[model samples]
Target: MDTNDKHYRNPEAVLDLYERPPLATWPLLSLQHLFSMFGATVLVPLLVGLDPSIALFSSGIGTILHILITKGRIPAYMSSSFSFIVPSVALMKTAGYAGVAQGTIAVGLVYLVVATIVGIAGSGWIDRALPPIVVGPIVIVIGLSVASSAADNAMMNGKHYDLTYFGVAIFTLLVTVLFNMYLKGFWSNIAILLGIVCGYVLSVALGIVDFSKVISTPWLKLPAFEFPYISYTPKKIYWDAILSFAPIAFVTMAEHLGHIMVLDELTHRNFFKNPGLHRTLAGDGTASIFAGLVGGPPITSYGENIGVMAVNKIFSVYVIIGAAVFAALFGFVGKLSALIQTIPGPVIGGISFILFGVIASSGLRILVDNKVDFNRKRNLMIASVILVIGIGNAYLQIGSFQFTGIGVATVMGILLNLILPREALSEE
Candidate 1:
């Protein structure tokens, strides 16, 4: 069927189109998307010691690039992927930022190859290969695997856990929940951002916020852009770093698929069939490559933005475009970046508790929504093993290479679903 035929069949989807929303509401909705993704996007750079402004800048450019590539049909925001955090940090320590950049480029290349294969072979194979039994558990792993990081940050105070930090974190969490539940319209849509603002204020009141950096930073300044080859010292490629990080592309590819599936379910649109999964994958890959070359984190479709879309029901492509533009503009504001850095860890921790849990809950919802038969031994086994391995942080190592909790769980779930016999126990 033609794209126009598809659009005519689903009238509701027109609301999410670029021209539907009033021009005045565009910025506000865009702000909601930006705020929804800001906490996590900035956190990636903070964790890996990359410049947050550059990350934000790249995210903006990457997202715009994605929208352009996808013909603005998919209403997804591209940002830093959490999957790259561990490898990126390790690469920085071992081979420096240049190596990390190269590794990220390698990952993008892997995505491009996968996209090419999917484009030729079609997405029908994907459905038979990864049903809800496999996809649901992998989604759960994506969220639960990083659960501990939230707790660690919430309780952290330099070297030890602090009651004050916990108190602030709880306060932030409460604010977010309250706003999300009680507020209406724009306020409800920006609950997380509001919570962060409140938490930041509380932290400043408690003397935990260091203003020295913000005070010194200029109002208007460009992001410290780092090019792949030109920015590196010794000016050479690191094949070892590239190889080490390249394997992670397998994991992220699975994650990319999961994101598309979740989005399909949420939007009630067949994204896999519309733009075709190949285009989406290619768009994401192109964004990642651009980000890597610019010394930013690997970009992907953000789950956090997905959560916001679930809540607000505003999926206009123009809204995301506005957000992307704002993000890029913010990157040029030196003081704005500094101020974001000054936000205490606990505040981020508190917001993460909600965001990550939202992801986990979404996975559960997908299973329930699809009516996956857990009574079956095959289904039960797949779900149980995936959750345990992922949450338990199991790892498999082979010489210099390693598979993380989510990675191992994703691979195992797919293998189990493929090998195990298909049978459902009859209802008693």
Candidate 2:
């Protein structure tokens, strides 16, 4: 039969795969993709003391929603965003978990607004508004802002720098690095998971792990789901929290565009032109809203899954669909959720140390890759001010509302980029 005739008989066969691999390969491929994103997805919820199961479930639903929204064209997985970690933690302290959810929903709304604008106009304005000068520092702040939290966790909630916990953290970090750098194929992809397992074992031997919760937990139970609006009333709403966290969406929006660009290079397809920025942004925004409603972390495109696709040469959207199914299914197992919660604080801390550092480094790479002129007075002024504001946790209050650290820095960077004269931006 001709290629066209064969494709007609099996519509899925002709989609993106070079050749339709066997059904047996699908699960394994899906699992690989899941493994790649597993560490980061679980870490976000763990950091904020949320249910990892809910995050996993929300991510699966969000990924599926994104696929449906984009007509299954773009190959991306939606998962908890680290960008929300610092703000979510801060907001949770003042506004409570419900407040965090409300703020997150506000951020998702921002995405919808931006998506609407992109739908009407093109993505050019997004680039103009958030040049590398603006985005690079914001990304750095997103990571650096939380650096102390990692250290605090490593010290067992700031008790002190005990050698035992520090030792465990270092071991986990080394294991993850070794697996990622030296391993090949499947082993390499699961480096982070393997590192966690090794760290968990060490923690157990050191008598740090608490298994009582795991034993008491049921094997099968529904996820602990919470609704944002229903859980909190207007009187309890922290408008300041909403204002502070919502603008982070602008950072993630730029990140979404970067992810699409990476996918385009990996798949050799112009996803931006095909799925179009509007569809992708809208899909992401909708997914984030869903996640927020369920009291899960905000969703963003998974770079880990993108890395999986790049390594395996598998670009099939169905693989991501299968992974999403697995994630959602795992969310229903109460024992699995309990087990995740049982993970020692130090183990999370160690992994986070690496993860947060990687985030900061990625920001640096963005500036380097884009050839951003740091020597220029304009760039230096913008970057330096952002770093100070974010790292110093400089908080600005207007009435009852407040902008903290990253929020204030992000606004400053954007405004500076816009207000600075071009001629004054000359190279040093």
Candidate 3:
């Protein structure tokens, strides 16, 4: 496969078609990819007390806008990440959703800070401090800390308060695992979606779902649109946005490196050398900025989709572009949002159980891949401190600013990795 094949040759020569993907090849790839991420794309809005429909539309629009800004050179989709869920939900409660939205807009500005730093200092500075030691544990905490929440929701029932939902959630989890472990072709690619469908059908049979909300939602409704309003007032939360969203780039950047590694393996090409780290960081940062600008969550290069691409052997960037186009169009449609809403909480909650677990597992995998030493006293000390501080929500207070949970753990890991004796390095 030549790296540069043009899609939709135009007389005017618009749409640079990075790597020159064909015009006609986008729909199925795009639609399938869109559906794959639908359950997740609108989740941020729903969690943060924003209109889910608006979130869907914005996510799609933000994605396309990011691609356009980058000239469609990167094969990635932006969606809602759960890392912001706690802070967003908290912001919505303490301040109004509008306040949280304002904070999110400021969060986008944080991306510009990252982009600027990367543009000037480059990714090397970041790469040194945040190697697998620091990043791996933080990623693990990202998933494990939420493990209880997903399971609790999955098992909750308003009816009798029995463990029935737990059963359903477990069944779905098993199906997803079995599919990924044994299934091949398209079936393997959509293990999560298939698991959700099976869980949904079962829940409906059990009388767990209520479609009343879907019925009440208007078919031709317009999504609420609000642009980010810049403000200088203290109540506007310009500082809180920086505190909540800035640290997230550390997590996202690590994931980006893993995605690049995945791409390199899939295409048998050196994505690092060709597009180079510079181009990829530029693309990821651009996507994140658009995400924050439109009151959506930050966009990270998702490992799940990258796994799908690897499994299906789909190397064309057009597929991702197709996915972005479909997402943007679907965002504008009210019924689509309504239908997504109809997805029972148990169903999504059930999947979240597995998804969150996998995230933590991925972090562990990073450590294992790096051969981190667990037996050494120094290594164990650092790792133990990270797990305890992160999972325990230990924080170090400095005046008004507080660092806790993943942030505290991340900083500690970096310090240990740098200042600790060589014997402290894990030999796993």
- Candidate 1 clash figure, as a count: 0
lDDT at residue 105 of model 3 (Cα atoms): 53
Alpha-carbon TM-score of each model against the true structure: 0.88, 0.71, 0.73
Give the range of the ten consecutive residues with the poorest summed lDDT in model 3: 8-17
lDDT of 1 by residue, 311-345 (tens): 55566778889999989998998887777677787
Candidate 1, which segments miss by more than 4 Å at Cα?
Answer: 1-25, 46-49, 85-97, 228-236, 424-428
lDDT of 2 by residue, 274-366 (tens): 567888988998898899898798899876676555444566788889889988987898776567666776776776776666656657866
Q: Give the TM-score of candidate 1.
A: 0.88
Better of 1 and 3 by TM-score: 1
Cα lDDT, all candidates = 0.80, 0.74, 0.62
Residue 128's lDDT in candidate 3: 64
The best candidate in terms of lDDT: 1
